[model samples]
Target: MDMGNRDTIGRRILIVGGTTEARELAGLLVDAGYEVITSLAGRTDTPRFPAGIVRIGGFGGKEGLARYIRENCIDLLVDATHPFAAQISANCVAAAADADVPLIRLERPAWKKPEGATWIEVGTAQDAADALPRGARVLLTVGRQELGPFLAYTGCHYTARMIEVPAGLPDDWRVIAARGPFTLEDELHLMQERGITHLVTKNSGGTQVAGKLEAAVQLSIPIIVIKRPRLPKANAVDSVVWAHQSVTRIFRTG
Candidate 1:
């Protein structure tokens, strides 16, 4: 991937990024002298930015995104969003096709159930809530946006963790505001201190927040894992390096 002397100087790329892979890819492309633009969903109050042009908020929908691609003369489109962000990812696929731009999806793999772990896998957030036992003290690692389904489960107590505090939470539910890469020890301490009986989270993969899975196994806590939503088919890669190479090859061949 010798991007140094390539004809990427005038090539413009658009990255629909929010995950860590997106930031790394943006930096790599920017360093390679490609004109890069990264778009964020604006869901987070303070988001980590990459080393290139950054745009916050959505482009309406698939139609709006295609319009943006055409209007901006984008040569390549990359979607490096969260795995659970199905709607946006689907939109990216449709928009790229509509705009006739080469699209690449940098989606990280989902987490697998650990050995000796009691994982009740479900398709949706509501299913997870329904699968929980009555009067359970649950530790919720699912994002704030996905907390709606659990609200109806008045029989359980929830300790929800997220980067930002979402509004309209129940009075009895506890909230922890923090970011991840939490160590196993930290997870163990949190679960023990809170007396967590069950763990609820999405199988978002990546090592950044995987400590909870190991901790749950060690603590013998039943985990209600929400399966990832089905996304539109696209040219998807699982790693940043692969995505970078794909982008380079597309630029060279196109």
Candidate 2:
């Protein structure tokens, strides 16, 4: 996988997208004169696209992904998907290994519960549901995909804020179709309006969605945060800046 200090002029790089980190890295790579392509899973009704080339939909699995890497001559593979996107991250590892391509992960660090914040950490959505007090009003921001487990809690009134509404939600639960980059003021008002006594969210680190946490803290609402699934160990960076530096180093050394 080592392509040490050589002519990197026309090198092709593939970034596994669906996160802010991926988009930022793609912009950096494109600015550095590399041919960059970002791949999205297409789960969202409207997914954000990065600056360079973009490909949507899954690659079938490891074999299909490997084929794409080979056909496109991808020199470097960057896994920058969502922290909770464990399956895609696993597939990326297998595909990169199969294709014999160097891979790195650009992952944002998981958010730590701040001091004075009332947080109840749990391993899964089910755990979060179980941890909630009976008959509590919950603000579920954990997305549509993982809503199934929480459905078992018919006693709790859940106000789900998602980009896409999920079917079969408990009748007692309510849904709000919306996107993020939510302001703190808006979040505070929402919590107040819904009488949100508890919040359910994945520990998806980054300031883009941190407003909810701030609002919760201000209102003294208890949060049931689902812990991040363990990612397979790999070469990784916590920031886009460091990821760009890694690519630059690889190109310079190659």
Candidate 3:
């Protein structure tokens, strides 16, 4: 499988994306003179795409993805998909291998601890809620999907920061319906406004949405840090830069 001269005129890149890293990677690769086509899962409405071709919905599973790769003559398959997306990653591995399209993964960095912040690590959202102070005003910075586990607990107040309207929120729960790249100032203000003395969130690392941690620190809030979900074991690069280098290398080898 000689995928030659990726640097030549225009090479096609298929980025399976629905995350911040995916979009950022697409834009960077497109700027570097690649024909980048981003595919989304269509779970969200009116998704914004990079400055290139955009396709929505699944490839109808692995076989469909392979067919799309062959029919489109895709040169590179960049798995910029979300970390928790194990199935699609496996599909990318199997399908791209079947199609003989070179595949790579764009992984985001994980968050680390900083000084002067009290952090308690928890395995589940329910554990987080349990660890919070009784009657504490809580900032549930974890996404809406995980909040249901905590709904049964009435020990603390929950202030959930979410992008969409969440389901199964208790009558007592407070919701912040907004998107983010939330500034530290705004996050601080929100924390203060909601009377947040305890915070809970996943370590969903990326500069696009990490401001809340800084806000939590400045406010001297206790945070229950839900660990990041593990990704599939594969040949993965930690950034778009690494993926691009691999793209060039893959072509050079054959």
Candidate 4:
């Protein structure tokens, strides 16, 4: 869609955001004189706020999102959520279509298995739980929502690390509440101190928290990597800068 003679001065962008890239892109667009609105899932008790306007919680679904876009007159829709957040990404595609707005996805690349690392790639959290052996001391980094499958596996000991401590965890399971961009030294110390034999995580790629993979390799700990869920096709980019540029191009062409 050509926005002929249109400018970025008053153009409004709605970013379906939860990742660092989304936060960064919002800053860029705001600086470029675009009205940016960031939407968060609100699963976390406290989320890192991004520049520009912020809205918390789901859009109901695609229909709700489409209505919001139409009512708010959103000029562009940017999907920059987690790679494994397939539901939101799918919803963004449908909502953008229904609202007749341009949509761009800024998804980071998936993590590749490091050299000499023992990586067991699985399709789902349940598969990762099943792949664990009995008596294993596991480091679970797959987030709180995914803990249900692993809860049934009583044979393994779990040490879950997340941004927030989830309620109703088993008494025996250890919880580490922290944010990411962890150093290799810190990850090594945590794994060694906890006697972690297996590291289970989603392959939500980024330098943030990538130290765990390196730490697992150094300590000879096997890693269970959960594959990313499928998302609908869109104009996708891999970095925040590219997303910013795409928005600029859209306005320039229009």
For residue 96, model 2's alpha carbon misses the true position, in angstroms, by 1.7
56-131 per-residue lDDT for model 4 (tens digits): 9999999999999987778999999999889989999999999999999999988999999999999999999999
Question: Which residue pairs in candidate 4 collide?
Answer: 3-254, 4-254
lDDT of each: 0.91, 0.87, 0.80, 0.92
The C-alpha local distance difference test score for the whole of candidate 3 amounts to 0.80
Worst 10 residues of 1 by lDDT: 1-10
| Candidates by lDDT, descending order | 4, 1, 2, 3
Stretches of candidate 4 off by over 4 Å are 1-8
User: Which residue pairs in candidate 3 collide?
Assistant: none
- How do the residues 1-254 of candidate 2 rate in per-residue lDDT, one tens digit apiece? 33233335678898998888898889888997898889998888788889888989999988899998887788889999999999888988999999998888989988889778998899988898889888899999998888887786678788999988867676767889998889999999999999999989999898898999999999999988999999788888999999998888887787
Q: Name the 10 consecutive residues with the lowest summed lDDT in model 3.
A: 1-10
| TM-score result, candidate 4 | 0.95
TM-scores for every candidate against the unseen true structure: 0.95, 0.93, 0.86, 0.95
Which pairs clash (backbone N, Cα, C closer than 3 Å) in model 2? 4-253, 4-254, 5-253, 5-254, 6-254
**Which candidate, 1 or 2, would have the higher lDDT against the true structure?**
1
